[model samples]
Target: KQAMDFYDRALKLASTIPELQFPLMTYLGKGNALVRVGRVDEAKRVLDEALAVAEGDSAYGYEAELLLQLGLIADQQKDTARALALLARATNLAQKAGGNRIVAEIALETGRIQRQASRPSEAESTLRAGIDVARHMAERLLLPRLLGDLADLQVSNSRYAEARALLEEASDLLEGLLTNASSPWVRSRIIDSMDGIFLARVRLEGAQGQNASRLFAVLEQARGRAMSELVSARDSSNPAELRAGERKIAALQLKLLRTTDRSARQRLLDEIFRAEEELAPAATESFIRTRASRRKPVTLPELQRQLRADEVFLEFALAEPHSYALIATNHSARIHRLAGRADIRKTITA
Candidate 1:
């Protein structure tokens, strides 16, 4: 709660700071602050006013974007119907405006909200539409992120082979772009884009833990107490809950990256561990219904052959309330549970 309080204060500060420099960015900050405080109608009115002034080919396009933002605000407020309705309107406007990029953006946003609402089939269709648009436009940057999002949805829906293909495509695209990027900013943006790709791979690893290869297998261990309970409650858990927990963990991890305060970082780490704890690693209904993907793990000799003499391979995985280390060498590989993430964090920050 203290960490959240600090986050709140930071948000308030950011909303007021005039040093943001860019006029559009400042306006967006104010608009977002209004939405956060339940002044949705007021925010909508402001967008409506802006739409009143926009002209020509850009008018409907801008209007579509504003509607998309409102749809996102509705989703945040848990008004799924309102959100989807707004997105539909935005999509129609974007299509009429004839901009493939805006069309793709609305599709992606709508799909994400749909996934959150647990309409997986609809979400998949919407995401696939966006992917098609992205491919048509030759949108190298946007396509990878869309692929990652759909990969995540596929994992949740227990389409492991589909998920694996999408993740591999995204990973390959991202790595290819990293080699092609000409500037530091471009490289950094590409790196930021890999977060979801890595996350989807992690989910795939966890879901296929029983038999899959460790290509992206960081690790998976449940909270000790929850293990027995998890098996008993296995059929009760849903894809929505798993996706929600992963989103929470991702948000906290992002916060951890931005924070410098020792105490606040620890709190965020603790929250991450606790959030992960609730997500015990038992298959959902989709997983139970679908056959898992199969792949061969890299042998110890193969892994060692790829590594330099000075480089030792170590993979850290957040196994719910606790953490673990998978250490590999030329001759062998082993995994052992370490202390909780908070303890490791404290030790590092000390």
Candidate 2:
């Protein structure tokens, strides 16, 4: 609020002094403030006015900034199409103005928007190109952010190993940047990236069953750290920082809960339920029938062979069966041994 008030006063003074530069800058600043406060409509109006002035005076920087601000506002509203269009224009203007940093940032943001809209292939290419540009320009801040976004897309597409590598690099870069600064925002971002890496590792471990206990332990520790960070942010005066921390905390909590129980049987059941939910009512009957037939019981030897080959496939079998049969494969005819079967006995006077 105070910042906005000062910008408003400065705008008035700039008008009085008839300084074209200050008024344009002040209007852009005020528009950004309005957007931050969730007043998107008002922000658009203010930015449009700034754009008109910039166009009239041929102020390229101010025009590009206004376009970027409007793009951010559109992104906040989930209007990806408009956001991409505005950002494209801003990137072109920034390129023409030799603002490489702004161009890199806009490209990174556009890729993120594409990723959010489920365009992973496009997001991957766009973000990689942006990262290259950022790296060439030595845009350290934008580089790590773009890398993290790309890593997230990789994870979403089941490229776990690639995601892990990307996340590790992002975490390392973020940590190095944090070491020289006392910026809470930067530290929070680094922690968020580290948490993501740990969560991905946990998912991988859970699937493999190689270190389930260790994975859960790491998840619990990360959840605790995220919650503590949220508490610290809540104690701060910055609402935006607090909100970001709170969101991270919520996401960590939900993801931890979901990944902690990775039993194969449970996962299979969940998958079945999900499929049923997604299918139409008329189609569900056939789907269920097909699923049941697909889940037919296998013999003990077959089950053992499957479990030995792939642990992930173990959840599809019945935990307990009505009978147990031991078959010796070395015998000429495969002798079968059955246990727990009692024959009926009768005692008669004869």
Candidate 3:
């Protein structure tokens, strides 16, 4: 491939470029390109060099990314055990580095590998964790694929209703993304796959004596949207930007908690609130700059109104000394104190 050739040429000259920054990235790119072209041996050597460079750096995200690439190469070579081990290490490093997107991707791949290894339960658990991380991080690009994979797993398990929900959500998210900057044929391919899920949903809803026509109508409408929008609206604030805001808020909150002076605490609280407000929007406008004045914290009534009649929303907040779970139903609200990190993990695993 031309791309691979380009990378190969570039890599050959990279060692002579003394001014090159992040040489690890150059090796990483070249290794990935080599892997794509089936130059497995060369890719392994280059990737190993990248990994060595990454190991010497304080940034674990680079190390994690390199590990993931190496794991993929191993997977392609039919080295399942080694692939899984590499991916597991990548996942751990990604979590430590706050690389949520990479964590989701590795988890999704790990799930697929487990499924291939005939560990269905582990696959399901891993996929669910990936889906959760993707959703929480607003990772639209990874979320649809992760959801689709999980839905496929659900289909295999004969959990049709759950699968239907997952597919519909995935379709919706994919459709929204496609509308922004993608070819109509992309949506066409997505719809072709989703039509099967729609048919299954119709059958299930019919069996339950519920109206299924509305579902079909919604799907059709989504599919019928104009192919060309003639304009552009893009969200520049990606997960990384939101993450930056989150970190700032968290640091200020911690400082506020530890400060004994009322004025200092108030200032820290104000900064935290401002950061939170900037990230509060469920839907962001790409045309305009995001500002703290553009959003506000959701009030109890607003949150209550947002919940469906049969649905309960549980929001977790990890704070000093204790963690809290705020549970909200249609008309009631309550807070539950989490036992501890270990207990929470055990409860989640159970």
lDDT of 3 by residue, 1-350 (tens): 77767766776776578686556666777887787777889989988877887787666898899899899899999999999999999999999999999999999889989888988898999999998999999987678777877876776677778977887888788666654534434545655545544444333332333332333343334333321121222334456766677678788888888899999988887887778788766224322232211222245566578889999876553422244555668787655655555677768899
* Arranged by TM-score, best first: 1, 2, 3
Tell me the lDDT of candidate 3. 0.69
User: TM-score of each candidate?
Assistant: 0.57, 0.55, 0.53
**Candidate 2 segments whose C-alpha is farther than 4 A from its true place:** 1-5, 18-25, 36-38, 182-350
True-structure RMSD for candidate 3: 19.7
Clash count for candidate 3 is 0
The sequence of per-residue lDDT tens digits that candidate 1 reaches over residues 1-350 is 45335545654575587674223333345556677677777667655554554433256777677787878878877899999999998898888888799889888888988987889999999999999999999888889989988998887778899999998899889878865655546756886787657656766665555432263232221222124324433544457877787788899999999999999999999998888677655223334332122234445456677887677787776533355556766555655556766788889999
Give the residue spans of candidate 3 off by over 4 A: 1-19, 182-350
Task: Give Cα distance to truth, residue 185, candidate 3, Å.
Answer: 11
Candidate 2 lDDT over 1-350, as tens digits, reads: 89878987887777777644546567777887887787879889988877887888776666777888889889899888999899888878887887778878887888978877888888898889888888899876777777777776775677767766776676577656644434456566666656545544444334333433343343444555556555554443434543454455555455546675668546655655554444335343332332222122334344345443223321110011111222222111121222222321112222
C-alpha-based local distance difference test score of model 2: 0.62
- Please name the candidate that would achieve the greatest TM-score relative to the true structure: 1
Using TM-score as the measure, name the better of candidate 1 and candidate 2: 1
Q: Lowest summed-lDDT stretch of 10 residues in model 2? A: 314-323
